[model samples]
Target: MSIAASSDAARATRRPVNANGVPIHTTSFIGTNWTNRTAESPPPPEPGSYYPMAFLVEQPPGSVVQSHFHAADQFQVVVAGGGHLGRHAVRPVTVHYTNAHTAYGPITAGEAGLHYFTLRNGYDPGARYVPQEAAALKAVPGRTPWQTTTAPVEPGPVIEGPARMEEMLEPRADGLGAWRHILPPHAALTGPDPAQGMGQFWVVTGGRLDGMPPLSLIFVNPQDAARTAMAGAEGAECLILQYPRRAADA
Candidate 1:
């Protein structure tokens, strides 16, 4: 489904819980694939099927997520607070990508805590912690296990500049890419065709999207037409994330 989710509207779905004695809040934005999901509960999707998942996670100060990897490719965008993903420090608007089976992170929240949105084009049962599940980890023939990080974008004029797009993760032949757009009030920007990638997620990081406030999320399916983001009166800043072609697509 090609639809938009307003940040305010998603607030109703917020569920607070404790993970290993740490307080955390998970808010669903695009799909219900996350609710009550566990490592063995949600059955895997049919081969070659497409599933999109998007949500925001808030971790209290000093919270930590042990090093792990998922069975599906995903992107983690740090939208607020401060933290360290392994050795690299992260703050607002930092984008991190990891192909399936690529292990990374022991994410530790700083004094301010950590808030990030996780986006995925495929369903992953849950994280597989290292060493323990290490025996289950096997490399896929053609799926390159890779990782990338984009520099953070500060507030204000940094996002109020002339309407233009900045490459975050350079576009690849496999359709893996990311871009940030800075648009003046009411300005319009069309995204890359979804046919070229697994799917696309339009995230409003600054200002508004069709009048929706920041944190708004729009998911465009591969079969749908390219989405055009219309800035709200206050202007806008957005992140366009495209998933790479999966083996099933071949």
Candidate 2:
């Protein structure tokens, strides 16, 4: 399908409520034809299934994200910055920039703390941030807490190049399928893309993504399951969160 046709399809399938019950909005790009996903939602979990959510976080110098854990596995892609992990005396470590799938954080350490992002797998139900007791973990002064990172899994060999789109079979064992896409400037993908199966959420990272004409975010319900489009101008890279098909339909 042409980029326009694909965007129209995406809009037709856009889900209204994110996992957290937040209302989602889809807008078009100003100069070019494109769509962007915006908003935040709580993580959803179902027995045997997994859900994927993406965020574009910005931490000021020395800021810190208190340690936290989750029932399901979590992954993070560091787009920028250098930081340390662990409690007490933070361990010096550099985040992975090239590889998006690399897992970090949720490590177990003695008395000393384990510094890292990305929730650990098989911990508890729902997304879990650090508890109040451990809130002391702070990003060292002069450095911002880990921020401006992309968690989209690297695209597969079949789909390569500037449009670095990756499809990963979320290892939830619950029959849940989740994937992330990182599109470069002027790059776009058509549906029925995976984002359609699970309602999608997007965050802009860098460069403006023009959402106009055929390029847009679409939502389609089962009744018609087609014919809807929402476009927006994404000034740079954006993040996307997609809920499971069952949850989205719910």
Candidate 3:
């Protein structure tokens, strides 16, 4: 569903908590906890930020996720702890992009456990287990020649204050890309225009980004009318996502 553009949208913040302000229930990701905000369709239709669905997964120590792929594209960030994304070490704030049907993982979390935020631009296509196939195709988990792009797997330098935008991925249509917004109190941002068939999403990583204040994960579908400008409630920082336009409609 496309999030209609809003010339006047109110920012609403939904923490990863429940109606009582406690964190919400989570689904199991292998042996981990998956806290999803937009795993389903749009609702709580007040303060949509960027994409339609997103989740936070906490992987336990020694956790191993089998090699798998999804029918849809994904953008995952390592928020805390340390782990191996395939063989690449993933630490806090490492932003990773994966194309449709791209294979990844065998993620082994560090002692402190690995925590990451996962976002999806399109529908949840679920997971396809393919440990054997994934292993056969991999020379390197994230840098496979055919499945990889030149995008940085790690996050770029943090830009603070003044409300700056960093185009982590070149603008394209379809799928997903990476972006970050660093804002001081009362600052605002408009996501870069997406290529046709492409959409954007905004998620607050540090402080609060909202149409109103403390907006957490808000979806911004292609033409969402609910809200336009994202403002920092305080010393806020955010990660923006763009679904890269693809060919063959793939």
Candidate 4:
């Protein structure tokens, strides 16, 4: 499926805020069948804080995602057919939660990919997700690379290479940071080394995997980094959600 763009007509059609003080805005990207019960916004972090959580979701078949990692803790869950997780030996571990900070990839060899979602604890401007600096935490050796071109835009160092890991940081705000990952067939992605941040939470959104039932969800605590990975079989795709922590004053 093509990535949906925010349209001027859709923006013009935004409804006015109701009596509940919610800002009116057009919603897209989120699945059409899903309901929008709340407003979405970007977070504004103070100067230094640390909140970390994440969600992993599964998407429809035939999706593709480039290899990448973030500077926060991460997590994932299998929502569809079995896939591979990193370069390790392929196993039939379906619908299980894995921690952030370790490398993982799809396990299956077919065309079907696993869909999952993750949420990390990070900064947010009001209800909007944002990124901020942590306390005096030193960057993980060779792991804190940053990037600015991706969605949920932030101003951190850009990460490079296929063998890099994510860095952990403290949150400067209070709220949840959200992101989505689309993994394609026959692809491989690794996680940031755990010693960098906190942990993560994940959820599955679509597709079907071997060991995991449809729509299954799980959490990847900080200690389980070595066990996370996904692999797609024939004609499968996965959507993973990630939430990072935020500070109380953000």
Candidate 5:
């Protein structure tokens, strides 16, 4: 098969994407009061593969996100403000990757409060506070405190790179992996690096992603890496998902 044909065939294997980023106005789910703007929704054509979705999460000044857990794994990019991940001091652009049922938070917002973009991959049964007995907890017992296979929580920033690209964190069995990509204004991905052939969802965190908006993200099959285009005047940075794209049975 020709390279382009082969690439198109590969891209066709993944889920369908309804272009145009969705807005996530406001939500007060969990125990804390916060807001969000969604960029992607559940994959429409798949049943068990990683169905990644991206959204913005915000907490007001002086507020706190009580300790909690979720049914699916997640990545949080502190896109603005500063805060505490339990005890660690976290500022804008600090990244946090947490596995299912991995307890974390009691996150108190800093003077400027907190704002983040949460990219979730897998089944989202919703958020549940720590302590299985909490009434605010939403996950069922079986999936509530789901079998944790990675550390409860991870926090930090993407490593600086001369190429403006870097693998921020590697995933464990239960953890999700993340990579940061920085592009100068009007520049774009030359092509998907062969090393990044599994699959990825680019979450636009800084500046603007021409075809998409800030807080938006798009998934690309490794084989069809050339299908992506990044263009904007102020340059851009994105948090890319590094999780496997196969079905649970595969």
Candidate 6:
């Protein structure tokens, strides 16, 4: 398991890119530097093993991210501002999941701009854009173009009570699931077993978790024992994101 506070994350912007003649506008808050994009010469991706990646992308208002797909499954949580992720309007607390190689998006930031965190359990070279990379996409073995969006919820102040749990994405046979938990001040709550899925990411969307403020993140591996989340004085509201069963396990 790994725990990190967003405030301590490394921040950077890619060298100006305008291959398509459209400026790529983004600032990254990197929580794990498995492959440092900010390095003068970023290292090549390691092969044969998993390296988790978690980072936040901040887009200025009106900026657009072209439709693309990645080589690994990922969960993107919109943490603030508003946008249309493809055709779906996305706002804070909205969860979006896409299976590996499943193309999606053309994310357009709203007037307030958009902020989202990208969480993945394995390494991916980078985004493969549509139309331009359309042939490359067709060359790869197809996985189901599986994707889903959860309704957005406004984070509220914590209440006094035993922690409350809500299923934002219904658990499926393949073990993909998403949950939101609200913990009262200083209360401790054991999360769902990580062994039940490929991996899990606990995100502090509101209040605090073990003294870490909002945007704090925890990544739990499948072999890790179920971990407990203890709320800080202001309480905590967290979103749990789990990946589906890996092919080997299935």
Q: Which candidate is the best by TM-score?
A: 1
* lDDT for each candidate structure: 0.83, 0.31, 0.54, 0.31, 0.52, 0.78
- Lowest-lDDT window of 10 residues in candidate 3? 25-34
lDDT of 1 by residue, 14-89 (tens): 8986554557898988754545466775575742246788889998899898888876788999999999998889
Which of candidates 2 and 5 reaches a greater lDDT?
5
lDDT-best of 3 and 5:
3
Q: Give the per-residue lDDT digits (tens) of candidate 6, residues 1-250.
A: 5555454454443323442334544334433343345566456465213556777766778888889988878999999899999899999999999988889998889999888888887777677789889888778764667899888988877699678889999998788999999988898978888889888888889888877778878888888899886888988999999888867765
TM-score, model 6 to reference: 0.88
Candidate 5: tens digits of C-alpha lDDT, residues 1-250: 0011111222222222211122222322211111222345323423223444554555667667777776555667676788787777777667776655567776777788777756554545345666653554443443423221122223223333333766667554432466667777777664344233344556666666655555555655444534455657767666666543333423
**Model 5 TM:** 0.61
Q: What is the per-residue lDDT of model 3 for residues 182-243, given as tens digits with 9 covering 90 to 100?
A: 77666666665544435565656666555433224555655544334555445566767766
Least accurate 10 contiguous residues by lDDT in model 2: 27-36
Candidate 6 stretches with Cα past 4 Å from truth are 9-35, 38-49
| TM-score per model over all chains | 0.90, 0.33, 0.65, 0.31, 0.61, 0.88
Candidate 5 stretches greater than 4 Å from native: 1-50, 133-162, 171-176, 190-199, 221-227, 244-249
Decreasing TM-score order of the candidates: 1, 6, 3, 5, 2, 4
C-alpha-based local distance difference test score of model 1: 0.83
- Runs in model 3 deviating more than 4 A are 1-51, 132-161, 172-176, 195-197, 211-215, 225-227, 248-250
In candidate 6, position 210 carries an lDDT of 76
lDDT of 4 by residue, 1-250 (tens): 1111222222332333221122222222222211123445334343113443322233324433323233443433333344454443212223222222222332333356444333334321122111222221223343433221111212122222222222222222321222333334333434333323344333323232222333333434344552244524421123333333323222
At residue 69, candidate 1 shows an lDDT of 82
Candidate 4 vs. truth: CA RMSD?
16.6
Candidate 6: deviation at residue 142, Å?
4.5
Candidate of highest lDDT: 1
lDDT of 2 at 54: 25
Clashing pairs in 6: none
